[model samples]
Target: MESQVTNNANALRLFFTDDVFVVEDKSVQIVLPAVTEAVSATVSIPKVEAKEAVVVVENTVIPAEKPLPPSESYAQKGEILPIVEEPLQPKAFKFLGGNKKSVLILVNDAAYDVSTEQGRELLRKIVKAVDLATPDFALLNYANYKGTTYAELHQFFKPQIMLSFGVEASHLQLNLNWAGEIIVHETTRIIFAPNLHPLDSDLSAKKSLWGNLQKIK
Candidate 1:
């Protein structure tokens, strides 16, 4: 009912002017012409086609990787295992003399073959000067028996006098720095000197060794 009243008020505004005041007798009448037929509007919409989805698959082959064998399997493949070196067996003490007088003579000469008669000629002369022979003392090459301890030598040779040449007391496992000195250790007279191979031409060293040898005897 309120909407109807609003529509009627809008219609009255179109007929009345703001500046003019009209009396009932001076009012003008307006009539709008009507159409004989009613008109209708029609809208057309376009149609879209529906499509099915396509999928592609590929067939690929991957080779399997061979696995590694255990450490023991190496032997089956003709491959040797890592060489674990055994502890160096204590070398059997090889001496040139009979050691009748319990005198141990040591020399370090890897270059010269002391086993030969000509090679040991200098050693023969040195022993002869001290009034000794091959049978009187044990001649040992320190080069061959490098890691031999003092206890091992003492047990084997039972040396009363150890005349070492070209080797130090420490080489025999004796910790003393008694090189070029004559000292009695455990009743064994030890004299360390330069290599006798060079002493053939060294007169002063030979004289000094001889002087020490006399006291030991």
Candidate 2:
């Protein structure tokens, strides 16, 4: 009789005989009796670590409301605004009279006040002496005269002749278009004293004065 045994990491085989017994490695060949038995070894497997879990969250926000704009106001009734007017300035008058041209004689001096009635009379006498029918004359005295009154005199009689007698350094202003035959007599001739008109016939005398004044160049 014969016997044999074999062992492996996972399994083992064994046999028995009357005469002899033998032992061999797992991969080696072995002869065994018909009553042999095989045994399988149990194996243990390790568990793997669980995978990590993931979480998802969703959030939403809403904004606050804003205020609206205010409405416009209505205008009030019965409000009156004042009108503005500009002040008037003085202006010289131009010549408008035809062949019957007028004359203006001015004696600009500090020694005489032509604005006064006495001074005007003296100047009228002097102008009359130039000719018995000498043109109408007016003397503007700036020394004693106001600017408003002088402007008024310019407005009243638009003369054609302007004479500055005994004038020092002051300038006599007259309308250039209306004034003609400007004469400057510095002498104290007072020849005009005899040419005085009747106090009652001032208008007729003025007419005669303008007629004679037209004869001047």
Candidate 3:
């Protein structure tokens, strides 16, 4: 019986051979041997847990477009034309030889030519005659002949009634006629004649001749 007890003690020493042993309460205890050096040991472990998954959602908005006007479309077509008007003609007057009663004499003595001197003198005489015969006559010298300087002699004169000799009647006729109370003379007529008819009466329908001769006188 003592031998069996020794055998049991040896078996227990083998089973608890390590320096530490685990107990039923999950705690550990270290054992030291009496006749040998003590041994040590350390143990490590990890814990794990279960989890669930998740999802997410969202929403958004957009804007609408607008239409253009009809007039803007027509403007882009490019087919319309603009209207224009004709210019009116200037009124004509007797610029040279006419009735002494309504005559306007313009003497151009500015000409350097010697031949024009006699013409200038003759113009002076005609101007004097017109002034004496009709108080309504207008006499302008070379200094006063403004507007068209290089225009035709008649255009330069612009007379209501022109009493002239030689080139004067010819120049007057170039731009005007006997229509507007004109009495042209190639040669000086000693006897003067007056038109009994009123000056506003349409003597010629060729040109647009209107306006009262009373205004001119």
For lDDT, the strongest prediction is 1
Candidate 3 error regions (>4 Å) = 1-103, 106-115, 132-159, 162-217
State model 1's lDDT.
Answer: 0.77
lDDT of each: 0.77, 0.41, 0.37
lDDT tens readout by residue for model 1, 1-217: 4464444777888777588765686466656687666656555666666666666666667778778675665366667778997754444688888899999998888875463454367677768877898789988888887778877788778899998888787777787877456888888988887777676667788787888877865
Query: Superposing all C-alpha atoms, what RMSD in Å does each candidate have to the true structure?
Result: 20.3, 18.5, 17.7
lDDT of each residue in 94-182, candidate 3, tens digit only: 33243345444444333432115444454344345334443445444332333422133334334445432222333333333444343
lDDT tens digits, residues 46-126, model 2? Answer: 878797886665565666666666554353456555667754455543321231334444443355343346555755564
Please report the candidate that would top TM-score against the real structure.
1
Ranking by TM-score: 1, 2, 3
TM-score: the better of candidates 2 and 3: 2
Q: List the residue pairs that clash in candidate 3.
A: 96-162, 97-162, 98-162, 98-183, 103-161
TM-score of each: 0.53, 0.25, 0.24
- What candidate 2 gets wrong by more than 4 Å, as runs, is 1-101, 111-125, 132-135, 146-156, 167-217
* Winner of 1 and 2 under lDDT: 1
Model 2 C-alpha RMSD to native = 18.5
Ranking by lDDT: 1, 2, 3
